[model samples]
Target: MTDTLIKVDLSQSAYDNDMIHNRWHPDIPMVAWVRPGDDFIVECVDWTGGQIKNDDDASDVRDVDLSQVHFLSGPIGVKGAEPGDLLVVDFLDIGAFSDSLWGFNGFFSKKNGGGFLTEHFPEAQKSIWDIKGMFTSSRHIPGVNFAGLIHPGLIGCLPSKEMLNTWNTREAELYNTDPDRVPALATLPYGPTAHMGRMQGDAAKSAAAEGARTVPPREHGGNCDIKDLSRGAKVFFPVYVDGGGLSMGDLHFSQGDGEITFCGAIEMAGWIHLKVSLIKGGMAKYGVKNPIFKPSPITPTYNDYLIFEGISVDEGGKQHYLDVHIAYRQACLNAIEYLKKFGYSGAQAYAILGTAPVQGHISGVVDIPNACATLWLPTEIFEFSIQPGADGPTIFDTKGIDVPLAKDL
Candidate 1:
């Protein structure tokens, strides 16, 4: 087993400095050839590509170049892969970048996509975590610590050139109509200047022009930051092109469900132990095109104490559309109001909310007029007082909950 494991390094090639770090052009040569049954151990770099160092501070965090994010590991060619096959990747285990365990979490510039709460906390701020053993400690927010969940924030294959073209055309149209829906060039990984990491040569230029921006979660699974995909998680990706062109990076020590404020989740570099295999004709069998996954066991130590509820609803039903953002924000506002009873101001509440072990969930989206989102928070972190339970608000938890599918299903 040891001899069968291939190692994929995360450094520049002799010819192209930005080969594996900044760009994601399918034309870039594959670093290694992984067979269907091959086991591999990948050495991945910090998502920032040497931009943010371990010893860096919050000021340094603010200075980070947005273009250099998501420094990934491979375009590792799977020996027997073809389009439409399911590339099943099993995450065996994950570890810290090296012996020195440290990571950073900060809010990105508003010029970028601007995290969910970007307007709430405009100035960039960060917490440097001293991650060791199984827990993470932060000096920025003292007296709170929690066990970490190690997982690749990004794990998937490249989309076909046709699909890429469709995405670009659609997004360009969206940009022309509503630019806010698309991230700014500062935040777009595919933007021209974004082919960063010592941009040189023609392939680099083409990649810079055509690389898929690693921001949204697409069918190709670029930056799907699902938190529960810790060690032992098995993921299935739809292969859109030959060899599957698989890549992985953006490792997170831990993250909540929403990854709410986005510039996110205990960002760190680590070793990824993966087993690659394939399910022939799986796309037709499952009738799905995006990545599918089975998460490992969840943290049993913490129990959800508060569940904030929100709906894409208002006094007038005009605003009650299918926009999840409306529901998500309402749920977040519920959490903010809940935090206010504990003596936190609105902005401070949103900032701390982003870092806290809180999760957001769309309980159901199929509702006719009102879609609902729930914000779950753990009571374990609060030492002083939490409203309603710790002598605070008169929040009646009962008579307010609705069972949507309970009645029909």
Candidate 2:
């Protein structure tokens, strides 16, 4: 297999810069056909396109056209790929829009899909990061800078007809049951956000009511925002359509574990060099139904840290009743209290934890009535000294909050 570098041009429109497809539908025409072993450099527009511009400020966060959230670059078809097979996308290199790239992390808002702690914090916030080589620093939130590992936050193939129907049906049912939760499936844009003419793209004149949204991660892998898909990573997707109508977009300069707060980990416009190959009958072998990828450099050197642990417990005397969300919230609360020691207000700390280089892990879910979650905060990013909390009791110690333990039960 010889390396033939191909460039998929996405920098085309006046607004989008590159001609990119904001929608993903099986009926969408293939932008290009690459033979197996052909390497390509896909130019990805920033997740926002023109909805939010370089000159824009945090106030602009509210005006962002929510409908056009993820602007995907292509439905690049692989010549011989087919459904049920595993399409292997080899990420050779991922970086800035070109030599220079800047990104933003839009804070949680009530109008858009709510944040991890939406009820508590409803106001919007935006932080801009200047990307230089491997480093990222923001002036808004002074004192922290970290190496940026670039990767496509959203990448996947077109879903089969059956799969698409399943997606729509399940989504409809979910919305039908709870109108409030409907926002999860689709958040109406704050203003006029979508430029791609309605009923005109891949979903145009097709069986689908509209293009399948590029929000949720599906069998056809749309916004799976998992970090570590940097250089030398193998992303495998379960092909659902002929030629494995592959698409990629929503490149993130860097991201934390849950991307729990904002539109997600420092959203940016960039290019990812990909080389795709096929794994015939890989579905049967792996018994996996969706996209799965082996991230390179499996373990990362996450420098420094404060660890906050939380276990899910309910009111009264309860043990084996576990709520993962409660456990996660507990971890967040612990981290927030810890951040207070460093001079950050609770709300400030909440947004920072959501946007910063923090990592959250499910330490233990099998521990009977208590599922544990741990949040790891990297110390190196702080401009100030990393210090332990005071000798007295901490928030977790006196808590009747997010954490799951029933102390005086």
Question: Largest TM-score belongs to which candidate?
Answer: 2
Q: Could you tell me which 10 consecutive residues in candidate 2 have the lowest summed lDDT?
A: 400-409
Displacement of the residue 133 alpha carbon in candidate 2, Å? 1.8
TM-score of 2: 0.84
- TM-score to native of every candidate shown: 0.83, 0.84
* Candidate 1 Cα lDDT to native: 0.68
Per-candidate total of colliding backbone pairs = 0, 9
C-alpha root-mean-square deviation, each candidate: 8.2, 6.9
Model 1 worst lDDT window (10 residues): 400-409
For each candidate in the order shown, give its overall lDDT on alpha carbons: 0.68, 0.68
TM-score of 1: 0.83
Candidate 2 residue-wise lDDT at 139: 51
